[model samples]
Target: MSQAMRSEVAESWHRSAAAGVDVGAESSPITLPEDDLVEYRAAHALAPVYPLLDDALGEAARACDALLALSDHQGQLLWVTGTTQTLRRAEAIGFVEGASWDERLAGTNAPGTSLVLDRPTMVVGAEHYRESVRPWNCAAAPIHDPITGRILGVLDVTGGPDVASPQTMAMVRTAARLAESELTRLGGPIPVPHMIDGEVFVRADVTVQCLGRREAVLTVRGKAQVLSRRHSEILALLATSPRGLAGDELALLLYEGDVPATSTLRAEMNRLRGLLGEEVIGSRPYRLLVPVAGDWNLVRALLAAGDVVAAMRHYAGPVLPHSDAPGVVALRENLHGELRATIVASDQADLMAAWTRASWGADDYEVWTAQRDLLPATSPLQPLVRSQLARLDLEFA
Candidate 1:
């Protein structure tokens, strides 16, 4: 760990060292088989943007004997593009698609370090943690979910010392942003990556987010899709009702006064099934075949785990705030009440403070008062708390 190493690279080196990676390993240790790699890349979170990346970086990569590699959030390489000579040269060091370049397995490298920090990073020759990687210079940037800010994957350029230039950094970084911009227009997956043995790995799950936001975001197996209000309501109802709902049962919950015709509900269900797979929504009771989780569920779980701060972070706001469906309305009020009660009961001043700052809780007298009680008498925040409580009192009066 030389002070000559840039802080980010130095930090990654430390992490790579501590992870027990074999510093002497010549090639990346985690390589996916060719056929499996093909299928995996085709279904990857970055699949949609591959052609764009290829067109954007393909020529530039070949021009300078550099390779553009797109990796999943876990640093598993999905696409590696270069000219004949360049590709052959890179394969000498196992820099190919279907290999994991994560720091723990490959030691410190551009794409690996980018996933670790979730930011653009550059590693010049000899700055790399592994001796074998020291000859190549690379730059990488993490691509994220446009809405929720989850890291989806990484974009990297690996080649001769020319790859270390700021221009190379700018190109790779810009390409990463462009890919996310494409995702914003076209829906992309809400990928979730986890840490294991100091490595990032993705586990599949279906996530349906209908809280706070007017439109719901549904993600299945790393693919995200925005839903219409009706579909959102349907999912909210179906998710909450685990045992499932019959056509009439769902219609009643969905409608305001009278239950709609079975045809209407049938059409909606059919469309929803088309969007989320026919296997996802089952019949005879119309249950969710896959276990779905989302911000709403995560909040409940965090609260149960007694991590109130984390729960509040995930809360976003009441579930399906704009939905007037009987089931959704009931759900909205209950979850809001539970969250508010939890905040008031907890003695953590920070929790109360955060609650009071939210738009919905700005005038909440109860939470402000709870916050006032939690703050120490000598605390500097007392005046602000007192003023909010006083303002709440006048508003209530």
Candidate 2:
């Protein structure tokens, strides 16, 4: 189907689902779960994780006179802003990072419905599925990235349940537009786009700025870093590969049919290492800098896609920030294969073990659940997983 038609169907689904919530009114609100590991893990691992955009545009979203930013895609509230009263009301109605708003999970509401509809939307109180959601006026507008024009997220403004003001709707749209503008400004036209794994960087004039698939950078400071043609080409190559390249591999990628000497390739690596630093390359495996963790471009995609094999394959090595040698390419390939195979072989029981073994603060129920769901039933995992999940139910309950 055409993109437009599909989008229409999605929006229709949202509107019908949110039919009864009393959105724009003043009333006592509901309770939300405290910020905890379950909430953080789910939010952190969900598809379209917007840390980059959130970090960049949070201040503006908060400062907007009548706007709040939220993620409809994941059925979580994401972020909220505007007057203190409005925020309190929104929070009470279960619009937070960890709360589920899917019509399937939590009944009808703004975010889940908006995502189902794939369009901007407004949802009022009793229009909500749960009676607890009967107070609050919420209007939201979808925001898109200028480059790819994909729906990045929705901007929302919620107020007193009884308030039916048109200004609220207008304000939500305005905030969404402002957010779109900021996204564009943050990602500007670039002569050289840096592609270090998925940490894509676009040089404006002098300083290098990072970019993602959907957002733009427009600030003057971001525009100052202009990169050379070769640099841009090199960055792009590293960004797409499943494994890191050695000096010869990088040289082959950059040089193509031509055969560059080992020494010549070493010179380029040294120069790149000097400029980008040891953090971009690493002593182990002598690989290029391609961040596998934190807020990099591929991370959100990996989370959303929910393909652990692909994700593990992408993590070819410890994000080597400096080394590049011909011999290192083999090691990079081996690690990629190892990680993918390991994740593929893991079951829910193994996943819980992995989570248990992770750093104390990083053990997340979301990740544990996700890993569990992905395991094949025949993979010698079900019995052990059942036992662990049973234990978890008792512990959390």
Best by TM-score: 1
Candidate 1 CA-lDDT value: 0.78
Q: Over 4 Å off in model 2, which ranges?
A: 1-69, 82-91, 161-163, 188-304, 307-397
**Per-residue lDDT of candidate 2, residues 142-189 (tens digit):** 665444333445655554532336666665566666665655665622
TM-score of each: 0.53, 0.36
Candidate 2 TM-score versus the reference: 0.36
Candidate 2 colliding pairs, count: 58
Local distance difference test, per candidate? 0.78, 0.45
Give per-residue CA lDDT, model 1, range 280-355, as digits (tens): 9998898899777666766676566665644665567888888899988888898888888997887766566656
Looking at model 1, residue 9 earns an lDDT score of 73
Runs with alpha carbons beyond 4 Å of true place in candidate 1? 1-203
